[model samples]
Target: MIEVYTDGAANGDPGPSGAGIFIKKGKNNYHYAYPLGILSNHEAEFFAVIQALELCRKEFPEEILSFRSDSKLVVDVIEKGFTKNQKFLPLLQKIQEEAAHFSFFFIKWIPEKQNFHADKLSKKAIHLNKS
Candidate 1:
């Protein structure tokens, strides 16, 4: 099984943002910090999940995936397999598409404290975007 932890952050409600992904499989691990120009915090969170799903598809397509995120909205929407917000339809669709590639996929919400590593990486990406 592969475990993925993802987080997203924006300096403002609709400001410079970033997505952070941390992947672990057995003893191996991978980390990514990506700058996402300017987006709302919720958008960034959805993007983070999409980015992580793409990474897993590319690197570990056959493995079962367990995804963790600090965003309750993202986790809940994904778990429920639906979203009422029209703006999030595309993002949710992309996430579902990517997740379909895996043998099994699960997403859950974690406290920010438990997701510190990914959160820090996202903040770092935000700082990089400032330059």
Candidate 2:
């Protein structure tokens, strides 16, 4: 199984944001940071997971994926396979679609303290945003 830790950060509630992902496969580790122009923090969090899933699809297809995130909202929404919030509905749909490509996809909620690496990467990504 591959372990992936993901996080998202924004300068403000609806400001420049970024997604961070840390992937561990055996003894190897991979890191990624993506700048997203302008989005809410929640939207960034959802995008982080989406980015990770996309990466795994290309790098670890058909592999079991164990995803970790500090955002409870993102975790709950993905785990339950449903969301009522209009803003998140499309993001949720994208997640489900991406997840279907993997044979096994599992997501878990972790404390922010446990997600330090991804947190730092996300903050770095925020700085990378030009606008």
RMSD for each model, in Å, please? 1.0, 1.0
Cα misplacement distance, residue 51 of candidate 2 (Å):
0.5
For model 2, what is the C-alpha lDDT against the true structure? 0.94
* Candidate 1 lDDT over residue span 9-79, tens digit each: 99999999999998889999888999988999999999999988888888888899999999999998998
Winning model by TM-score: 2
Candidate 2: RMSD to truth? 1.0
Q: Write the per-residue lDDT of candidate 2 for residues 3-100, one digit (tens) a residue.
A: 99999999999999999999989999999989987999999999999999999999899789999999999999998989899999999999999999
Model 1 misses residue 117 by how many Å?
0.9
> What residue pairs are clashing in model 2?
none
Ten contiguous residues minimizing lDDT sum, candidate 1: 121-130
Global lDDT of model 1 = 0.91
Alpha-carbon runs more than 4 Å astray in model 2: none
Local lDDT at 96 for model 1: 90
